[model samples]
Target: MTGATTSVELRAHNRVRLLRAVHDCGAGRTRSQLTRDLGLARGTASVLVAGLAEDELLHEEPAAGRARGRPTQIPGPHPRGPVALAVDVREDAWELAECELGGRTTVLEVGPHDGTPEGALAPLGEAVAAHRRRLGHRVAGVGVALAGPVRPGGLVDIGHLGWRSVDVPLLLGLGPGTPIAVGNDTAFAALAEARRGRLRGVRVGLHLHVDFDVGGVLVVDGRPLQGAGGMGAEFGHMPLGGGDRPCACGAVGCWGMDVGANALLRHVGLAYGGGRGRAQAEHVLATSEEAVAAGARALGRGVAALVNAHDPEVVTLSGLGAELRERAGEALVAACEPGLMSIRRDRPPLIESSALGWRGALLGAMESVFDAFLTIEGLELWRRNRGDGGPDTPERQNVTNSTFAEDNSI
Candidate 1:
């Protein structure tokens, strides 16, 4: 390629590296710190920052003057840019937040819903439209966090929503070309925690978000393990109780029926009757403590079984039931102890409350959009901007590693 093209390609690569560094930081990184972090020259960092600022992907603010040094600009959430829209659909309500490139989120809308498929889509569409109107043409993509399994093409099968293989994308009236990614709410929340919250550096971990329903995700080496056909980590539906109470998934005694927030509400409602709302249900009282303890035991049992099978290093819990982490943290740990075999009893995985709180799912939804925008395809687009020939392609051929090995030496 030409010299100009090479320069452009290099710049694009540097910009992408910088963005990745910022994302990896999770909290925010200073420009000088980023320059050192990415091993780029100051001039190159300035150019990359300028280009990204022009693209509305970054905003710069003057750092607080301290000690004796030249003042620097700190990078923060950009006001203008391709904003990510995250929608969390719950059994009783829905929440929508607008997230910028750097993972900053602003709640735009949230309200109650009937939990029906159509009811879910209407408010979601309105939220997206409102955000689009405010953002104008800078809106990049929409990511939906559903309470149940979502197929590859954005079809959601939520028993609580009375939805069976419903196409959420089509119902939301999004254009064909617009990018939309749907994920299980718990899985996405797990992704968010792994990427930006407490689960960072955990090679193997499980994240459970107990809300209106019990949902969870298995993360191994920073990637959410999506099973064949994109449905994975349905930990809640796993059989736990004896063959008595029927579950929403048509199974008997599923773990979710006894452990999720809905279950806690039901437990309280049965005793109090029609008096428990979100606040009342989440209240930390003696009865609430007992209910939470029961849920914790069920969660511990499920987690222990998962540990024996997957051998994760840790498991984090979030959502309404996470408050129980403070009250029943030890009980949860103790309950998990019996499920382990003799050899593995020496090192049981730690169970902790999620650091990201309830926003984990929303943040994870934003991450889905970020992944799409910062892919190899995006690199190809940057290459085109530089007029480079494009990436190198190699023929598919299996080569034995032994071919590269030197002869045996004494």
Candidate 2:
């Protein structure tokens, strides 16, 4: 009901900011560095860090080889600090990783499926439960990237998996107490590109994580332009100007139907399924010269169409699409030039492969999980983990019904 920014809340915000400033600094940050970087006074910065250390969220490590000046300790993630769980669920597999405040990630497991995404839920739940038991309350929050369209009220519709209106939190056995952040896989990949990879400095970048099909997000600033119900940009669903083939998404002529691994597989007459996608694409690229050229040409046409519609500063691709962009090379560029407007033909957006490679979705998911904890209520969560048993604000972010819109300063 309250729409006001409070004083206590302001302090909590600053506390989280200071913690993040150090966390984002990779290895760690010195006392003086934290002070200067966070714009906090020396004593104030020390006090804030002391508070975090007391809560076991951060710790001070000695400057081992420093020969001169005051030997200052750099702030680092406590061995038993709060860790965010990052999950990237594919059509037939899922990867779970633990990310620390200091940006180090440990892949806990990658479980495969039996062509049943619905059945995958049980194992996913068990894995999360196991991780929670191992990490205790330090298992802060979870960021999940789903290979499907997540509808309003957290309902997911994965056409490939034949899953509709799936409640992610309930299926994962994540009770109401656990804060869960969910996003489309490709959108989160674009987020990864923007924050940690090729789109790092590009303002109007478009990240297309081409796998089974081309799905991506258009980044305006640093945030992906989310659609209604958080379905993300859903670029793949756009009608192809070429194909009449039926899409797995229950549509005909979808760009997704004609311009991904499936398309590549079909172009060379290969059996279709999520399992054999990578192997099939690799085989065609490695063995068949004609198939490789044909696939790349198709990719070129699709990329050109998308670029003509959305003038992104850069287009970063992952998976087989990236390989196509590479192999296609000048043929792809020349194919796209005619599609571009006269002015844009001279300076088309750069098409490049993902710098983060396979880890992009995982890293982006972890970032979301971490951001869920960088809020007013999150202050109390950290305090509670440190055994500071006290009544606090509601265990929810200050903003309601929306993610990525409020306090994205991180």
Candidate 3:
């Protein structure tokens, strides 16, 4: 009985590790590569692959290149397998996308939305429901990225949009049983960078997404350091920029007042409200050198303050932050150098633009959903539903039911 329970647990653990490895690879791997990477015997790996294939979670194809030996097969996400749904709810727009294993994402829909939370959520819920109906059980879970701080229990706080304590899951109308993970937009974007974008191999990294305002995450060892309540990185709220203007987040003299689209628009004397005036803001950055200089100076100084504190290996920028870096150039550097600590002035962290672009939040959301769905319990349920008794045969049922001390490890 003990041996049987151990075997079941080990099998589940190995399966999870295999899936996670494939997902991390981004391009999938051949059977030989998977076996070698996982350190599993050839027969054991074959059995595991066959089980996953039978459950419709994985499929194999001929290796891309012509090989010398037997035509080895490469495993990948099953064509009709489960997909994680993701939604990036921006300040004035939203995008819905789906992702399979190996980080492949397909944008399903994109549209603008009203400022009101109810108006924005209803259409999003409807769109998700429509996709659920079409895909049935293939929809593994849902992930939502919002332009705000997300607290526990999915409470969202979008300061600029004037929204507070928004119950994202309830409003999405996906029901209690539906697995929904809601998070901060910038945090998700940072996660995307840490996983598949610019921050992939960095030991410690900082990611900033400058939109109407600034927000970001601090990543250490490829994972975002989500604070005690999961609302840690609100860097824009820090008073790094010397200003007296009130911020939407009920704070005065926030660093955000000096940077982002709002700062650019304000510098250029354009009326901005509810995430509007992005076009005008861009035009201002392009046309008004003074506005660009001011915004860039503010952005660089604030980033330098953060650098002096966090000491990250690199800093990656996305959205309007990238534009600021490009437009500011030497002026931005001058502002940053003055603000940096004297000891660190010689060699500062590398600051660069992220290549992920708008897809960062969406990809991060999908990755979050996949993380939730690929758990041990979730995989066990999937196996049971598929009725493919790969390891747990009838004779092993009683033994498998017994609890073990290490059951929680996986």
How many residue pairs clash in all the candidates, one count each? 0, 0, 0
lDDT of 2 by residue, 1-410 (tens): 22438956655666888877866666466878778876777777777878778878888888678988878888888887888888988776889999998679999999987646557777997898788766766766788888777765456777766787888878887655456777788877888778778898788988878777778778878778876557657878877437787766788787777666676777788887554466676777777666666666666667777777788889888866777777777766776677677877878888899998877788888888777776656667566445332112232232221232321111
Among these predicted structures, which one has the highest lDDT? 3
| Per-model TM-score versus the true fold | 0.85, 0.87, 0.90
Q: Which candidate do you rate higher for lDDT, 1 or 2?
A: 2
Scored by CA lDDT, what does every candidate get? Answer: 0.70, 0.73, 0.81
Q: On residues 1-410, what C-alpha lDDT tens digit does candidate 1 reach at each position?
A: 22235776667667767776776675377899988987889998898888777766677887776556676777765665556788887776778988877787889889787667787787788778666656554555678887788776677787654689898877887644455678888888888988887788999998888875577778988877878877877888887523256765777777777676566777766432111245556663235677788777777777778788888888888986577677787777777788877666898878888989988888888888777666535434333322122111111001111111111000
User: How far is each candidate from the true structure, as Cα RMSD in Å?
Assistant: 9.5, 4.4, 5.7
Q: What TM-score does prediction 1 earn? A: 0.85
Stretch of 10 with least lDDT, candidate 1: 401-410
- Candidate 1 Cα misplacement greater than 4 A, ranges: 1-5, 241-243, 266-280, 283-286, 376-410
lDDT of 3: 0.81
Task: For candidate 1, give the lDDT.
Answer: 0.70
